[model samples]
Target chain A: MTDVSHRDAGLLRVDTDECKGCGLCIEACPPKVIRMDESLNPYGYRTARYAGAGCTGCGICFLVCPEPGAITVLRAARPRQSTAPGQQARP
Target chain B: MSSEPEVTWEIASSKPASFYSTYERKDELQHATHYCPGCGHGIIHKMLAQAIDELSIQDRTVLISPVGCSVFAYYYFDVGNVQAAHGRAPAVATAVKRSRPGSIVISYQGDGDLSAIGSAEILHAANRGEPITVIFVNNAIYSMTGGQMAPTTLLGQTSTTSPRGRSAAHEGYPLHVSELLATLEAPVYIERVGLGDNKQVAQAARAVRRALENQVRGLGFSLVEILSPCPTIWKMSPVESQRWVRDVMEKTFPLGVLRDHTQAAQSEAVPIPPPPLSMIPGIVGVADAGLPAEMTGDADVPALDLQVRVAGFGGQGVLLLGEVLAEAGLDAGLEVSWLPSYGPEMRSGTSNCHVRLSREPIDSPLVTHPDVLVAMNEPSLRKFCSTVHPGGWILYNGEASPEDCDCRGVHVLARPFTQIANNLGDARAANMVMLGALLEIAGNLPQSSVDSALGRLVRNPKWLALDETALVCGRRLMREARAEVSHAG
Candidate 1:
């Protein structure tokens, strides 16, 4: 079990209202952390949900998802100390 | 514990900016698209929108949505949208791209619409190397109008139209569109991708972007054919349908880049802009003669409305006589139209023409009932005499009018005009003599207009002189005939 305070390298958000519950994202997630919810959405179909841990954030789920807004992937920012001297900051 | 650095998350992937915030295609589903739950069009649309957003060309992009399920593509895409007829997306895209050369035009089509109905259009567009992008979605079967067989359907696939599972002898083999198009010389890029799994989806996204990028760079034609899955129509779960594409569909259509001439291809030639309205007359070699003085608000000029039907054998200048009449009407500042009907044979075949000269704008060129019938032969006279209007004049070329023709209330001037032309110089001038008599009866067009029209049409000076003499003789014949009738009365 992962500690609640520990931040993983990646995070994922699944909008229940926009999800059609096709399970493509769940099947495509490399970490196998996404699952179909037991409850139905407003349109009466099961929706995908993040399992709260072990996300690598490769963004394959976002690529395979049919709905544009259903899946959003986020990657953890690198530590400030690891920044190279001549490297430009991301905008 | 205090030494650990705090970590924050930033968005890696989200919805693209090219899609509308809310789809207003229907009242109920404002937030959702019209596609089925696991439909491939949604995924493809997202990839396309992402490309448009990344390229920063959303404002100048024109998406030509074709018939089939994706006909409502305009509802989702925020770019300039045009819904084309089934299978005509490529042709429509060509026109749009040529007219608005700066705009990025994309033709989105389906298997039934592209490979089946619009095969010729796509072939020609690609062959010409039209600087446009084509996104072809092939799902093997037609899903929009129920699951019917498509041109790209796999050989053993069972569709509503192919209930017994398509056989080679019955339906023939599946069409390889990417390969077929690659054989053409003009296309700069052609690739086939699939949406069966994550890897394929990622590759498809890259191909879609590259196809659009080629258009942005002004490279020649580029096409990306996507083998998409239809879950509902295939009667399989979404996952199983996708698996079918990878396992079964891939065997029939191997995925790869079929053609890549983008590196060697130069930017296509800029299309010539259409001429301005003022230059059209000069370009077409028509003198910009505005309406004549007599045509504008003149109360004394009779309201000229003449419908003339001229018919004869093919070599008897049937069409030329009609052309001269229409040209003279133009010179005289009247609205004119001439329609010719003839057989395939160049000579000795039947030919006819309808000529209309009206003061008002002519509605149609067809003259079902003419004010006068000029028949240069016996068969033509018998055929067209009944169609002349009541009290109209019939100028027949024979010695006398046919006894069986029901020329009840119409006036008949039956003269051997061919023999008269033979005495003058050539029998071919008989049409000119008939035209002269007809002009004398109408009395609307001036002799100067006819002379100018004849000068513009007749190239040989010898034939022109003989035709002029024939015309004077014809006028004399008509005058003498009228005098004799008055004396007999």
Candidate 2:
């Protein structure tokens, strides 16, 4: 819901040490690029991590994050190339 | 270089990033807050932080957190944080706002804190239209104190104290805080919002912002009552708690704007300014009088600073005597204070007052060792005679001073002050008679100031005439007693 969608293209990084695996961020992400990793964080709860290259750089995960500074979304300038081959990716 | 252009966006918290909690947890906790998962306080904190960031008021914002779950709000909100006593946030906030009127003071309180113990403080502060914002969180039960029955606990709701369902006959009805505060005239904005769903949460956010906005605009007394979810105590899942708030809690406390007087209040002119301090003497009817010659702070009379204690039965005008002395001292341009203490009984019970007069500002109103003791009866004389300072004077209203009482270095002026007042046809004027004798014995005032003070105090013309005659008789009796002592010597 924040203005991070202005660029329409970005990457995400979640701090494994700070994420409680609350999954609120996962529920909020429109692209579903965020997922709780199988590997346990230092405190033992599964930490959230970027799943694939489909991240739209939308900061919904950051806004819904209870832990401040846990999620960082870096947005890119132009339209991103899709991981899929041959088929035209819809915007 | 055949690549997509760089968007260049970084989601580092928010700009009031300073407003968010980047706390380094001692225990390495993952969450920014200590509140349990799905607690509405976390959401409310987020909304408030966003509002503060948007308004750019983080520097001037002062959050007063009282006891209960939000007691550790200082750790979350990175503003001027103040921890108030369990139920005294409104009072503390009042002083803070009044002293630093530029600052935005917010009193954050819970149901148990605001409704039960702090009811009077909030009511009076809101009634006075103090320019402060209050964020009241009603979670139905006392969550912090192990989920006890709160004033806002709904009927049929069970808490630790209300083991069974809350009964109307025994427990009474729930207190609608938003409705109660809305009844007050001073509050410019009042709303009750819930955090049940996204729609409700959005409405709550707006209410919080509007409440703070009213404060920013110098509007008086705004409060936003947030019906938050206490999932841990409610023994429900976080999602279930949300449903409970929406389906169940909303029935008891409906979500809506209860009142909004902001536009009307802002257009109205400010109230009249307070009168100047120089006008007080005139207002109290003491400006026209000429102070006695001896009271002009002369070197010959010596600076008179008297701490006098008057003690007697409740109905004997003991406090009245102290008041007259204090008023006369003020009329003579001296610093004065009068403090009274009495038992519960209205009459015949013990009563006392301490009166202090000083050329300089008085330090304290209490007189543990009085320079003068005016004992209205034999029991009062015996009780207080020992505490008189050495070389102090005691004016006792008896046939004769108690011979066995150890007055030591204290001088005694035992006389029938009441009998003299009775002779003047009013026994109640005895206190005025005693005042006359005390002033004459102290040899400070010219009796005119005392008369003016009596004129200011008493309203009836006939009683005022009788009191004037009584003062003359008291001064004459003091003169006669001095003469008798000199003759014997």
All candidates: TM-score of chain A: 0.78, 0.74
Specify the highest-TM-score model's number.
1
In the range B1-489, model 1's lDDT, one tens digit per residue, is: 546676677899888889898888544558777677778899999999999999999999999999888898898899999999889999999989987889999999999999999999999999999999999999998888789999899998999999999988999999999999999999999999999988899999999999999999999899999999888889988888888989999999999999999899898767786666788889887766676565353453345899999999888998999999999888888889999976421113578999999887788999989999999998888778889999898899999987888899888889999998998889889999988888887787888888999999998999899888888888788778778878989
Candidate 2 structure quality by residue, lDDT tens digits, B1-489: 325443555554432353445554223452455666556776677778778888999999999988887887787788998999988999999978876778889999988999999999899999998888999988999887678899899999999999997889999999997898888778888999987765677788789899999888887889999888877899986667777988999999999989899888773333344566799889999999886565345343336789999999878889988988888888777778999976421112578999998886677999999999999998888888999999988999988888888898988888888888988898888887887778886688646677788889888999889878877787787788789879999
Task: Count steric clashes of candidate 2.
Answer: 6
List where candidate 2 sits over 4 angstroms from the true fold.
Answer: A1-13, A23-34, A47-91, B12-15, B20-31, B267-489
Instruction: Return the number of clashes found in candidate 1.
Output: 0
* DockQ, Cα level, model 2: 0.13
Q: Candidate 2 chain A: minimum summed lDDT over ten consecutive residues — where?
A: A82-91
* Each prediction's whole-model lDDT (CA): 0.87, 0.78
Q: What DockQ, between 0 and 1, does each candidate earn?
A: 0.37, 0.13
TM-score versus the correct structure, for each prediction: 0.62, 0.55
